[model samples]
Target: MAKKLWVERNEDGSWDAYSDDGAHIKFGHGKGLFNPGDLMKVALAGCAALSSQFPIENALGEGKGARITVDGDYDEATDGYTAFREQVVVDAQSAGIHGDDAEKLKDRVERHIEKSCTVKHTYEVATPVTMKVKVITK
Candidate 1:
């Protein structure tokens, strides 16, 4: 299994994520004000991007690469959100392969990533959540 990564929040509302291999990355409020949920999207995009290259190369041969861009539309109320939409463009090609083939390859790659990515998997499972809030009068 691949090694795990960890992230910790400091007292000042900043965070540092570290890989098991000893790499550290800073994230949070001033350095980009995003939560763990937002970072999951980035992770999904990155996983999809890397996974896409394999099949394109298999069908089109080596020296071909693909660029994948992912987006999503979410409504906070329903949570029946479209998690990701990927736009993939192939930069190199082998004989007899055209844009249509590239698109199909993109679809295949997308499906593979959806099935394999950890963040995407998290979205597929509905976790039980409870919320409580307190109000104070000044």
Candidate 2:
């Protein structure tokens, strides 16, 4: 299923991004909005969590999820991020997974995330993006 997404500039000078499924996010250079870089970080973190969700829940019982945090340093000269660090935190001890079992689970989850996260893979491959501009006349 191909999903459509778009962004619109608001009257207040901020931008609103929307998906066909009714998802909306306030973005751009604003006080409480997410910038482009923030969105990229969030996408990577979300992809990691989702990729590992099934394995994590299976090992730690249903509803047990992992928290993923993604951070990076942006270089002004290049206008891009230098590196991103993603940390996935799962409390195996609380779920009765310990010692060797915990280590095994950790390794399994990492492998799953590494194999399944498309967003991370895209970033790793540095996917090419093309932009087009249209002019409207009255």
Candidate 3:
């Protein structure tokens, strides 16, 4: 389903990609672009954040503030990533999603993000990919 995502690197040494659904993302080592490792975080964390949107809203109602953070310690030599640590910080006191209700809502929100976020699920079950390198000699 994600094969539609395409990548391009410019002469300026910046990377850019297009998502299957038409999102344009830029990557680089400097400025506002996302570096390679940060991109991984963005993919997983962004998916989680987006996936949690509905649940957060449902629990706290519309227009409430909820922050989701996801981090993975990646080892490049092995291309292996450690378990992701996630934190969902909700402004319970201000938003009214406090006490027992907030705790249950937070638990449900985490579960929903883990279950429904595609990127997170994919990483949970790693897969082997077959690749072919093509050298174009035009």
Q: Please, what are the lDDT tens digits per residue for candidate 1 over residues 5-75?
A: 87888998889999888987777866566655566667776776666667767777776656666667887
Pairs that clash in candidate 3: none
**Which residue pairs collide, candidate 1?**
none
- Write model 2 residue lDDT over 66-138, tens digit each, in one string: 9889999999999999889999999887887888998988898999998999999988876788989999999
Candidate 1, which segments miss by more than 4 Å at Cα?
A: 10-12, 31-34, 59-65, 74-82, 92-96, 128-138
Worst 10 residues of 3 by lDDT: 88-97
Compute the lDDT for candidate 2.
0.91
Q: Considering summed lDDT, which 10 consecutive residues are worst modelled in model 2?
A: 120-129
lDDT of 3 by residue, 32-135 (tens): 87887787777887787777788777766787646767778887788877777767677767666677898798788888787788987887887778999999
- Separate clash counts for every candidate: 0, 0, 0
Model 2 segments beyond 4 Å from truth?
none
Q: What TM-score fits each model?
A: 0.58, 0.93, 0.83
Candidate 2 C-alpha error for residue 130, in Å:
1.2
Q: What lDDT would each prediction earn against the true structure?
A: 0.70, 0.91, 0.78
